[model samples]
Target: MENFKIDVDADGIALITFDVPGRSMNTLTSGVMAEIPQVVERIKTDDAIKGAVLTSGKASGFCAGADLGDMAGGMLAGGSLQEAYDAGWKLNGALRALETCGKPVAAAINGLALGGGLELTLACHYRVVGDSAKIQLGLPEIKVGLFPGGGGTQRLTRLIGVQAAMTAMTAGSSWRPNDAKGAGVVHEVVAAGTEVEAAKAWIKGGGKAVQPWDDKGFKQPGGGPYHPVGIQNFLVGNAMIRKQTYGNYPAATNLMKAVYEGIQVPMDAALRIETRYFIKTLMTPQAQAMIRSLFLSKQELDKGAVRPAGIPQSDPKKVTVIGAGMMGAGIAYVQALAGIETILIDRSQEDADKGKAHVEALLKKRLSRGQLTQEKYDALLASVTATTDYDLIKGSDLVIEAVFENREIKADVTKRAEAQLEGGAVFGSNTSTLPITGLAEASVRPEDFIGIHFFSPVDKMMLVEIILGEKTGEAAIAKSLDYVMKIKKTPIVVNDGRGFYTSRCFGTYVAEGLAMLEEGYAPALIDNLGRATGMPRGPLEMHDDVALDLSVKIAK
Candidate 1:
């Protein structure tokens, strides 16, 4: 039941090891917090312990930080904003206590130190790191629409220079140990598995446990030259934040404000400012919704929440794709890259050759970037077979009809593919708006009919909406899920309907933009509004990229 244990050596140095039970990576939770005070008290009371070194027992990670699931659970249970603030404040208090204790405390970072994990190390007097490439350290709360609720804002500014901390915190950039040491957050970088030993040695050598900010009259390093002039930093930083965040996210601004406000005050007052901002940010509805959607919903979806409860996993190693347009070509390339045997069929040899050439061009680009070796490119290219014959689909485990959106054309391809393939093989339509049930009308076995609606340029987009028609069997859904996962794409399952989810939601964005234009709003203003709303691309820009003709066609 113990999450931590302390052992004191003959030299009066204590090594406090954190090994949370039944977990692969250490995380800060209320349970972990409750135990930490006891360890801190031991170090405080024992006169024999002159210094301490903290390290994790886990090899996978140093710590992943606070459990977002636990936070979401509490929020769903109607926990008040004050309660969350108090919870965070308690952890901050523990970190501060560890910092101010008479004995020195050194942190040995062995792997990822994120959120509360990074905050823990920042509180220590010194830090050493292992040479693992996966050993990254950062406060990434902004990605989920929140700032670091702990003392991350205050400590990071005081440790690294303010400009560096501001960029790191606002961007949520994780750094390697060597980069961290260069930024002054870490003291030394050692070989893998030697971080703890290096930290122990430092503490034993009487390294000062007090942080630079703890010393009176400590001016920040490189103050005059690098500091932004006369609120220029605030203006430029806020503008960039607005551009990137589209004002949909409030965390970035709040974090920037915290670091700016805190850097002007002493450490204690700075921490209070950080806590206030943290509490205020947590109360925002956008933060709550983002945490729920991005964390909890994503977790559930990843665990196959949309799949039928009793359905087992199935891998469709061989797939046949009809047509040689952008969608078909992209799907074929992704499938081949995943090592799946893909049969790409077109109406003519010229079209099939064009599709195969597209795959080769993509592989060549990857090779230029060093993302693919010549050998890998050869192997991936070998996985794809191009043809103009329907008979070539006989061995396909699944056949995706990606031809023109004409219902009769799709129906014809579906009938032909079914006749050529096995009885149990699933038929998927890559149509954006067509109902899977309507498409199933062409199939003799509707249970084998499903919709694998991939967005344009499928290899780049992460979302793949799998539409389950009324007659689609559990095995069909399972196979679709397996295929999407195998190709390293996230699948969102939706009931059979026109434009299922993303497409339907996207229509609203375009409609709003067009409505604004009709109401005498300038195109520039509409574009700005879209950017402010956090759309990756403005509606007008997206309309141009997708072409106005295509939008008209989809609407029809």
Candidate 2:
């Protein structure tokens, strides 16, 4: 039942360790919060204690901020807005109390000090971090469409300069120990596995519990001289954020406002403003929808709701791809690279040979980039066996038809591949538009048919949408899930429908951009705006690269 422990040594140096029994990482949950006051009281009452160091028992650094699972549960239970507000207020108060404690405190940051974890460190008088690559520090609540509800906004701005904090908060970029130290976030960087010792040394060395900003009536360095420069930073940063997010995200902008406003006031006033903004941003429909789509829905889909529970998994060692076109070759290359024996079959030897060559070129590029060794490349190339023979697919655990978009052509390939494979072998179609149920009509065993839709340039795209038709059995879905995981790609399962969720939602972004262009908006402006919104590519540029023809094809 122990959530935290304070061990006071004879010399009056206390170590406040957060173990949080039954959890691998410490998260600021209600139970954990409830225990903090008692621990604080103990430290306050102990006359012998001169100073303390806070550290985590888990390898994952401090806490991972507030527990989203707990937050979602409370919100779902129809909790009042005031209740949520009070919860956040109480957590902030606890952190502030620690900061103002009579005894000095040091944070031993071992791993990731993120969100609430980083806020805790900011509250400490000094921080010493381990040089672990896994140790990332940041307040990335913006990724989930929320600001740091804790005192992260005010504390981060005070620790670093305003502009640096603005960039980090809005971009939601985590930093390594070196970078954190350079940004003035962490006071010292110690070697990995030695953070606790370093923290203890600092505390025993009589390090004062005074932050720089508090000690010297600190004015933000480079504020006036750099105020004009902030205009450019804000403009370019806004543009970049918009381009990446497609204006679909609001958290970035809200975070920008928080950093911008918080830096203008003293720490106390800044903290109040930050908390108010955090609550306001959290209640926005965009934030709630993002939380639902990016967190809740994504979690459910990743857990294999589309896969059947009782079906045994499929280890697809051998896969047959029945097309030599762009999509087909991409699939073949990915399969071969994953060490799966792949057969790239086409209507002619030349066609199949071209697909083989495409894979070779990709692997050679990887070798040249030092991403693959020559021996690995050779082995990967050897995994792909190309031919014009349909009979070569007989032993394949799965067959993916990647031929032309015509229904009859796809149906023919489906039937031909199904005839060659065993009854249990799954049949998949790499169709972007066709309904899975309709494609299943061509299969002898309709229950074995499903859609394994790969985005273009399959080797690069992280998402593989698995579509389950009405007649597709548990075994087919299960096998598909297993295969997708084996290839080291994220699987998002959706019920069979035209232009599944990503494609459907993505089309809206491109279409809107085009609509703006058609209304005499400059293509550059539209593109810049899209990039500023946080999309990887500008809409018009991506449209041209993907070809307007394909968008039309998918639309149909």
Candidate 3:
């Protein structure tokens, strides 16, 4: 009752507003979860409530799903198998009861509805969403090292065929409000403010009070998993999963199992199967580490935990990127997309122009796909200036050197950039292995020098390793943290050293691979087994992706 406020209209329609106190976004915490079954029971017993409409009181979104902080170990903080099962089944059971409570319920989703948020809508007999592309809806639990435990795999697969549901869930992909209708995830897409009324209208106007699965003769779309078509889907799906994840991500594999098997049974039994797999997944070492890193550590770092104290955050509006090769181009692209003015310089005008062309190619693809509007595309394109002129970088608040892994060239560029940089401007080297202190030797302002090592294909990679040199100042650290936040990348700060943290850690993997190779193991075999152990890629593949024998040399 504290989390959910219910108002019954004259027509016996109960409008349940989900507004968790002291939270900008509504997430299913233990308190919220505890209230769920109570709400379901009220809906089932109250004669005044003919139907229910669920909406969020907060403007941020409907719900963000289970609070990852609570979910870190809370779901299976266990005593026995039965206790774990009960813990996982809490939401699943509440949702199941709501769906079969003999009264209609429609979810009025206004903004982002992810993971259990989307799962909540799936349980509703009818769902209406706001007509805005900004409203994202999907099961993104897998991204945070968890699978959707609240009847997601079963209900979503049942609602929108197995292929579409399973594919999006596994990919941690979200759908816009416009696409949700076509995908059958939502019943209506009304104007933003009308979503709640729309849901109530659906219920009061005698919308089917029964869920598709709860009704008689509910044949799953595209047939069950054992059907000839579904059989092929499983065969191909399993092969594709193995090829991609290699049994490393138990959350992904378990989700696949939960969906593949859940589709064959009745709803209640299917939910139990999903819960079992979810609990099993939570117990895995990979999932535990992923939860710690992706949720806890990533959250802390994203909040600037690694940043130096007592310095005000300074997000650079204009940044200078030296070297218009792939790495530099990628950095420029992300900067421009974030509405920052970027000067992308190269040795040749042609290469500088090629860097600009890279941004054009990417934007045009988005524009053609309707993801980017013409106005926004033009604005983003105008944000970057690609040229060979070093003079163009004079007013930049920050400069990042992204040239090759050579010392002399880097030092030369550092001096050239330093000549034009104003006092307080931070200098960053995009080197993977060179120590920040060593790179700072070329700088006139060592305290202002740092290393902002971006991963290859910077636009796609979310991580930016910030290296603090021996003389790196608090202002420089603070500046780098804010700048990475502006571009929406995660940052982890480390002291200057050879290979830094990531590259050094990566070298160990390659060292093992190299030792195995010397022992007469094949590259493909080692790589495959490496991937099977949950690596994003094999050591060789990782080195290849970095455009380097970099890890190999680092390992040596």
Candidate 4:
């Protein structure tokens, strides 16, 4: 009752709203899970309550998912493996009880429902989603090196087909309301403010207490795992999973095992099968490490934990990008998409126009996919100005130089852009290899200069490494972090070094592969081995993509 606000209407319809105290978003913590059974009992015991509607009181989303910090900590706590295994079963038992409690329950998903959040809804007899593109629903536990422990593997596969369920859980892809409804994850999609009412109406209209899977003579959606169709799917799916993961991710393999083995049994037995493998996955070190870095650490960094305290946040209204190359063009496009006035500069109008054309090409692709409206695309195009004039950069809050990676050329461009900027404006260099401190020597205000290293083909890569120069002030670093956050990209702060962070580690990987070639290792064998180890591309292929001719010139 503490985590949930319950009220029974005159019609005996109980609405339980989830709103975790002391947190901005709702997450299924140990306290929340303990409260769930009590709430379910309240709905069952109260004769006035005929049916129940579960929803969230938060504006942000329904729930962010299970509290990973609590779950991961308990799984890795100083206890026997049996202790951890027992902890996972508590939630599974509660969800199973809720599903079979003999009362019709409807889930009114107002916003994002992920992992345990989505799993809880699967127990409900009916689900209604709010019509918002920003609303995301999925079981993204795989990203944190965990599988769904709350009967998700069994229920999702039963609700949707095995192939669809496998893709959703493994890839951690979130779906919009319409997409989720079409995929059979939700029963209906309504306007943003009407999801709760829609769910209540379903309950009020006497929705079935019994789930389809719980009915007698029920069958799996795509046939059990041994059927001709299922056999082909499992064989092909298992091979593809192994190839994609290269056997490094124990979670993926175990997930496949759970799905294949569980589908052959009754609902109760299937849930037990999933729980066994889910516990097995929890015992692995991969889950602990991934939860620490990807979930816990990522949450801290995204909150600007590294940014200097007491410095006010900076929102750049007008930004300038110096260069018309691939990196610069991508930067301009993203900036414009964020609704910032972007000035893209090059040596001549022809070159600057080419950069603008790049933005147009990307915009048209989005438009064709219905991700963007033509009107919005035109507005974004109009926000970007392609020019050869550095004078136009005046009054800009931030100017990023994505020019050639030559010290002299970067220095020259830095000086030109700095001269045009107003006082106290921050400047960044999108250099992957060069140190930010060395590049700062070219600026009049070295304190305002910082490194904002973006990956190649910038629009697709989510990470943006922010390097703090030796002389870089807190203001510059703070503003750069703000800019990266504005673009909705993950930022990692590091001290200035040659190829700071990602690039340095990446260079070391390619260097080892090149050494193998010199030692007479077959190129094909080395490439195959690299990919077998789950590297996205072979080291040799990656180097060539970075331009081998450029590497030769750098060596000279």
1-556 in candidate 2: lDDT tens per residue?
Answer: 3888888887788888988788778888778777777777777788988888889988766888777767645533446777656665666777777777777889998778888888888888899998765678998888788888778877776666556777788777888888889988888998888887898898888888766656656766546224876455566767776655666676777776777677777666667677667766777888888788877766565656566677776688999999988888999988887889999999999999999999999998888755687898899999998899998998899998888777899988887888789878999988877889988888889898989999878889868888889898878888999888778777877887777777677777888999999999999899888877767788899899878888776666
Q: Evaluate all candidate structures by whole-model CA lDDT and list the values in order.
A: 0.84, 0.80, 0.88, 0.88
Residue runs of model 2 more than 4 Å from their true location after superposition: 9-12, 72-84, 224-250, 309-423, 441-444, 456-462, 482-490, 505-541, 549-556
Where does candidate 1 stray beyond 4 Å? 5-17, 46-51, 72-84, 132-135, 176-185, 204-206, 221-231, 242-248, 315-397, 401-409, 456-460, 485-488
TM-score of 4: 0.94
Cα-based lDDT at residue 109, candidate 4: 95
Candidate 3: which stretches are off by over 4 Å? 235-240, 369-372, 541-556
Collision count for each candidate, in order: 0, 22, 0, 0
lDDT of 3 at 243: 83
Ranking of predictions according to TM-score: 4, 3, 1, 2
Instruction: Put down candidate 4 lDDT per residue, 1-556, tens digits, no spaces.
Output: 6799998888888989999998989998989988888987887788888999999999989988889898767655757777776777778888888888889999999989999999989989999998876688999999888888888888889889898999888898888889999999999999998987999899878799888889987788887667888677689899989888888889999999998998888888888788889988977888878888998888888878788888998898899999988899999988988889999999999999999999989988878766787899899999999999999999999999999878999999998999988888999999988889888988899999999888868889878999989999999889998898888778999999887999888788788889999999998888888887768888888898898887665554
> Could you arrange the candidates by lDDT from highest to lowest?
3, 4, 1, 2
- Candidate 3: tens digits of C-alpha lDDT, residues 341-432: 99999999899999999988888887887668899999999988988888888888999999978889999999999999999999999999
Local accuracy of candidate 1 as per-residue lDDT tens digits, 395-509:
7889998998788899999889999978778899998888889989999999989999888788798788899898999889998888888888878989987778887887778
lDDT for position 191 in model 4: 91
The candidate maximizing TM-score is 4
- Model 1, global lDDT: 0.84
Q: Which pairs of residues collide in model 4?
A: none
